[model samples]
Target: MEVLKERFGQIGSQSVYSFTLKNDEEMEVTVINYGCIITRINVPDADGMIENIVLGHDTLDEYVNDPYFLGAVVGRVAGRIKGGSFELEGQSFTLAQNDNTNHLHGGLKGFGKVVWDAKVMEDGVLFSYLSRDGEEGYPGNLYIEVTYRLTNDNELSIHYRAQSDQKTLLTATNHSYFNLSGNLKRDVLNHSLHLKSSRVLELDKEFLPTGRIMEVNDTPFDFTKGGTVKRGAESDYPQNVLVGQGYDHPYILDKNHDHEIVLKDPESGRTLTVESDEPAVVVYSGNSLKAEGDFRGVPSRKYLGICLETQAYPDSIHHPNFPSMVLEKGEMYSSVTRYKFGIED
Candidate 1:
């Protein structure tokens, strides 16, 4: 394994650096300190040809100006907080309602928009950030560390660790639009996806979780068995229509298997397996990707890529039945999510 670092660009008065991690199989992953964003992931196709699969921007300016979370570490709280208000320890705290009437992806300026202190390790890069008390209407001084590692076995591992000085709500995940086909012009509708989830979190008209966990037994949201992205989207099922165009809702992961999700691009014979400790995974079909110019310098259309965001349930703080996202004072918070890349035999 080898690690290389270079100056990426300038964010305000701070200089951003990009670190590249290469393994023996010729797999390379590049990440920038700005938002600890993953800039590239070059892996081999069925024909042994290398291709970049993750969607992102070319320069720091594009990332700074881009609204889509593309390739960045998102959080403080990854999903929605209904009404932008939550009660913790008898205190009611209101957050910024950036997504319609709900608080989405932390706030207006989330962790994805901030610069992190980065350090290069033997086989990975470590990023650290300090979120002060009341930074985004949260009540704690949170210290976070996220590490991205490329293992020799062809797995891109992300490990997140955080601690709060005061009790606070915290959940985070990486938002990377992936196109396993290695063709940016094409949509991921043809790719086959299999999720180890029997139920999905139902959402309201506002796209906030309704605290209802509905079974995906016969619905379009069912991916318990492998299915194409287009088939799932084209189903006139009420849940499909309720979420707008495509799959933007979270699937409650079954904890029975080590691999919670598997995505395959039959054209390129490339496959991706997602294994995470998180309770749920939000499978976003890139319904809102209308990019004038993307990382490849081409116009991007909807469904050009997909995001399998592994994190805790959205709006879990308000639902007592859902797993708690609360981090008590003096308690360590840790989570791990891995994306393993491979080619079909």
Candidate 2:
């Protein structure tokens, strides 16, 4: 572990920090303090060359105000809340509903805007943030901690722990746009993708679930085995098209002890395998990405990075069938997701 560089010094009352962590394989991980973001991750290609795969800005200001989700830790609650409200035990509570009719990513003052307290741990760093009751219209006083462990084995393990004084909804996930092939300007349509799921929640135009959990079998949403994203994206598949011409639905994976999502960079031969204990994962392709002008990505243009976010289903509080997101008093909430990086032999 080493401090390669500090991204920002002091901007008025705000302070930001960025440090680099190198493992035995020479894989480098740059983490930022603001929002506990992962600024960059440089890994080796098949031929033993290094390149940054995660999308990000060169300056801290770009991330501070960036709506791209870039590399920030997202929560209080990760996905969307239907109608910006939920009914729990006959009690109805309304939320800010930042996303049109839904409450997306914890509203306007989400975890992305808050600064996290940082500590240099043995192998990586730990970022912590506290959410007060009614902050962004959420309930309970919540204490959350996220640990980013960049291991020598080229694995980035994210561990989440939270506790609340009162029972409240809590689900946290890191929103890092990943383009493993180092092509940020180009779209990720050609990348090979595999998800360990057979059924998934269908979504409406607003990206909210349509209250139906359908099977991915014989549908374009099927990525049960490895397949390209554009295969079904171009078809008339109902859910695939509604997912904004890409992948943005939460797949209910099979209950096995294996990895859930595996992405292989055909050009670079860099493979990223994701395994999580979470019940479902939201696979969102960068459909809204624009690469026309100066705001393009690294080597590729728009829609290059894809996000595989591990968490409970969206609007879980309202869906009794989905796993519970409520953190009761005296009870601890713990979840773990790991990304193992390697090159194809």
Candidate 3:
């Protein structure tokens, strides 16, 4: 096992650095302090061919100009908040309407656009950031820490911890777009996906949760038996069209299953299993992806990559029956999500 660090770039007066953590199994995970972004993950296929499995850019300039969030941590609140405002403790608060009429991904420069303090851990890296009370129109001076670790067992684990000085809404998640075919050889439409979820939070036309839970029994959202992602991406279902002809809904996780979620590439025999403590996982099929120039990923197009964002239900603060995302003042907030990589054959 080894950990190496190098200067990545500069964000204002802050110096950005990238840390690479390697395991004895030939797995390497590189993370940068800028937005606590995962820059790279090199792992092997069934044929012993090691390649990068996640979408990323070649330089910091592309990262700074990226609108997709790429492979960074998103949030004071990960998803969209209704109408860019919410009531908290009998007080009305308004946030930046970056995503048209709603506050999307913590108002323009969310956690994904900030520079975090980095520390090298024994087998990983710890990235910490402090969000001022009024930063992004949130009412809390919060200190958060996210740890990224690569275990010898070929698991890339992420753990989050935080505490706020005042009550606030918070549901953070890592937004890593993964294309398991490795080296971007093909799109994810053919990647087999099996999700241990039977219900998904319904979304309205504006892509906001409608406080309704929809079943996946006979719909394109169904992934219980495991199949190619093409069903949802290529389907013209109303729900699918509501979000650029693909999935962008949060599926309520069924913890009763042993493996919560599994994504496999049949051709390369590369597999990724996701397990999280969060109640739901927002699966985005890269529905609206497009890029101007070449980068570490493939030619920009829809269904090129997919994101398995593990977090609390979106707009949970607006729905009484949903799981609460409020982190009380001085109370510790902790969550964990693990992504294990391996070969099926």
Candidate 4:
């Protein structure tokens, strides 16, 4: 394995770097210091053709202003927090309500939008950022570390670690929009996906969890057996139609199941298997993607890609039954998620 760094772009006079982690097998994953964003994941297909799989921009300025979150790490809290407020340790805290009445993806400027201090490693790169005590309304000076490693087995693993001076809410995940069709040749509608989840949290009209867990028995939301993504993206079911035209719900992860999620581009014979320790995953069908000028010239439309964000359920603090999102002071918070790539037989 080799790690190479290059100039990405800049925010003012500060220089952002892009680190490429390449294995002997011709798999290369490029990540940038700004937002610890994954700019590219070049892998070989069945025919031995290598191409980039994840959605990204052509330049750094595009990423700095991107609203889609593209291939960045999202945090402080991974998803929506109701009304951008929470009570902790007998105190009340208010956050920036960027998403209507709720807070989405941390706040106006979350981890995905900040430049992280980076260190090059023998096998990968480590990105660290210190979130100030009052930054984005969180009550902690949180130290975050995100490591991206690529091994000879064609596995790209993201390991997250964090510690804070004050107890705070933190759930981090990589928000890479994947379209395994190589160079954006097609949308993800034809891709077959299987998520080992039997239940998904019900959401309100505002897209916040309604505190109810709904079973994914027969609806298009059920990917327990595996099926085409189009089945859900184009379904007329109420939940399918409720959130745009596709899915944006968090599915409870069945911990005992093998291969928590699997995505395949049948035409390219490319398969991606995801394994993670998080209790839930937000399977976004890219229902809100609407860019056409930045994606290496590919016309971006709805369902252009998909996001498998493995983390504790968003807004878990409000739902007593969901997994906890609190990271105590001096307590270690760590989680690992692996994405293994291969050619489907």
**Top lDDT prediction, candidate number:** 4
lDDT of 2 at 221: 80
Model 3 clash tally, residue pairs = 0
- lDDT, residue 112, model 3: 96
Alpha carbon lDDT at 179, candidate 1: 92
Across 1-345, the per-residue lDDT of candidate 4 in tens digits comes to: 999999988888788999999999999999999988999999999999999999998799889878898899998898899989999978999998899879988899899998899999999999999999999999989999999999999999999999999999999999999999998999999999988889999888888899999999978888999999899777899888888888899999986336989999999999999999899999999998876554888887888889999989989988888889999999999999999999998
- In candidate 1, which residue pairs clash? none
lDDT of 2: 0.80
Residue 343 of model 4, lDDT score: 95
Instruction: Choose 2 or 3, whichever is better by lDDT.
Output: 3
Q: Work out candidate 4's RMSD over C-alphas.
A: 1.1
Per-residue alpha-carbon lDDT of candidate 2 for residues 1-345, written as tens digits (9 for 90 to 100): 554646465556878888678888889998887888887889988998888888887776677667777788888889899898886567777888788888988888688877778888767888888888888877788888888888878999889998988777888888988888763534577778888899999787888877789988888788887888677557677666676567788888786349678988787888999998888888888776665433233443445788888888888887777778888875889888999998877
Query: What are the per-residue Cα lDDT tens digits for candidate 1 across 52-85?
Result: 9988777898888878888988889998999998
In model 4, where do residues sit more than 4 Å from their true spots? none
The reply for model 1, stretches above 4 Å from the true place, is none
Candidate 3 error regions (>4 Å): none
Quote model 2's TM-score. 0.94
> For each predicted model, how many residue pairs clash, with residues at least 3 apart or on different chains?
0, 6, 0, 0
